[model samples]
Target: MARRQVNPRDLDLVIAAVHAVDPCPADQEAAWTDRVRERAVSLYVLGDTVGQDIARLDAAKQFTATLLDVRVEASSTRGVLVLRNTSGSSSSSSGPTAAIPRPGGR
Candidate 1:
């Protein structure tokens, strides 16, 4: 039996699907994020270099990290996720990773 090759685009779809779903209970959120992160890493490790899959995987990892941060903030604040830009810096010296705001304020 042969293993099937996984596409990096599929991982993007998975991330979008996860984002589309309503927030799960706080207890389960970590598991979901962990699983997604693990899958993304695994795909990255197994992906071929011909298609720039590595770059896509890197983007996915960043997206996953931002998602996890948002989930944690939402859970901690009881669903109110507030994002503030500090000092108009493009990159943060230290702090949480910047997240893209969801449309319609989520």
Candidate 2:
């Protein structure tokens, strides 16, 4: 018996497939966003190297961007990091480790 190593690309494909299935109902938008973030992070940790693939990463970013965009469009006040500081929170891990975003704009 032998343990087989999974290719990083295969993880990305799995994450992509997860997104395609629409895990949550329409009214449960937050849950849907959470799912995407969770899957994205798992993909990242699995060595997906999204930065190396602009198009694929861009698709992931769009999910976060849309969440932010909706907040802005609503004209309601909400802190981006404050809202997402949990499991699917936006943080240093979301971006390049070498150039992390500073808190409160430094």
Candidate 3:
């Protein structure tokens, strides 16, 4: 009976991820980035149903962060975005966005 709004932090997190993965080559236009961003958000939103862990919006501010930090920063490294926790517990979120290290130190 109501339309559920997606989280803004969810968006911020996804966009950061898109920038890291696609980085928009010089040849690409705004449309390309838009598409990429849209796709990223869609995927992230669908994470729970897609069988992935969900992170807290406030905990992850950087392109990558552990489950206590929430600050954004520029990053090219691929990683998972995890929710920040005051302390580690077996009951992890609904988490995780992180910058996975490049293979062979690429």
Candidate 4:
């Protein structure tokens, strides 16, 4: 059970990249990026190989892009986070939508 070491600078780069592509507000972007980084660290600690954790981070980036696209395209007032089923039976287009409460109840 060796611990995987991830460079903090690398994590910062990933967060910056996601924020650049994300349409969410600055506050939301910071929060989501932190959450994504935490998840990647958790995965790495839970026996995921370094490559697996990197892939997971990549998927998180993709998720951010998809969520932003969906929200903009849907013209949603409430923040919408799209959840994709990873099971082989579901396609990305058929994923479920979760409404996120926007800041200041907007």
Candidate 5:
């Protein structure tokens, strides 16, 4: 193959940009794990909190809004953490309600 000329300036710029954004692997990995865990907890807690709010609502719209939020969280299967809700109404369990993680959740 014929030798190709390289742009030293462009290469140096790329190197500088990469160095500017360098992250400690261990620290970043830990941070990412923590964020994922936090998001999972937030999603779970959001459903429960909305359900609690719905319990106190008499208007259909208010109750429906909260219910919708809960339903979305209950049904979410995408992402690293999957939350499966079981309830007589949810079709997952023949009971009032339960939130269970999918297999291999941890």
Candidate 6:
């Protein structure tokens, strides 16, 4: 496959554009791909951020919006997507998040 480019507002497109591989290799029908279908309210927090992992999981059950602007650092305006290491430490943190404006502008 060739390189692909996308914007935050158009991230939902990846759900359909993803290909199949591994244990649940169903391409667009994969379970992993299904989770992020509603990118606007997807919950993804730092895996090494103590209770945040479980908190994020619980919030997912109710379709809440968290991890909206996980930054690279305290002073950064950019966002990040974090991953865990073999020992449950923060291995990497990159990428951005997608979320539509909240209702009532709150």
**Which one is best on lDDT?**
3
lDDT tens digits by residue: candidate 3, 8-104:
9777767666765656668777867787777777676776655443345445454332554333323544543445444543222321333445566
Give residue 71's lDDT in candidate 5 (0 to 100): 26
lDDT of 4: 0.51
Model 4 agreement with the true structure over 6-84: per-residue lDDT tens digits? 8986666556555545455666877876666665556545544777877876776342232323342244444444433
TM-score, candidate 5, is 0.27
- What's each prediction's clash count? 0, 0, 23, 0, 0, 0
- TM-score, predicted candidate 3 vs. hidden true structure: 0.28
| TM-scores for all predictions | 0.25, 0.27, 0.28, 0.22, 0.27, 0.17
Give the higher-lDDT candidate: 3 or 4: 3
Task: Give per-residue CA lDDT, model 6, range 1-106, as digits (tens).
Answer: 9988777645544443333223344564556555544332332222236467668767763422333234344344443544444455553345334223333443
Q: Each prediction's Cα lDDT score?
A: 0.50, 0.51, 0.55, 0.51, 0.46, 0.43
Q: Which regions of candidate 1 deviate over 4 angstroms?
A: 1-26, 49-106
Error at 94, model 6, angstroms: 1.7
How good is model 2 by TM-score?
A: 0.27
For every candidate, C-alpha RMSD to the true structure in Å: 17.1, 18.0, 14.9, 15.9, 17.9, 19.3
User: How do the residues 20-39 of candidate 5 rate in per-residue lDDT, one tens digit apiece?
Assistant: 44353674877655555555
* Residue pairs in candidate 5 whose N, alpha carbon or C atoms collide under 3 angstroms: none
lDDT for model 1, please. Answer: 0.50
- Residue 27, candidate 5: C-alpha displacement in angstroms: 7.3
Between candidates 4 and 6, the one scoring higher on lDDT is 4
Candidate 3, which segments miss by more than 4 Å at Cα? 1-8, 50-106
Model 1, 28-74: lDDT tens digits are 98877766666655554555553576576577633111211233234
Kindly give the stretch of ten consecutive residues in candidate 3 with the minimal lDDT sum.
89-98
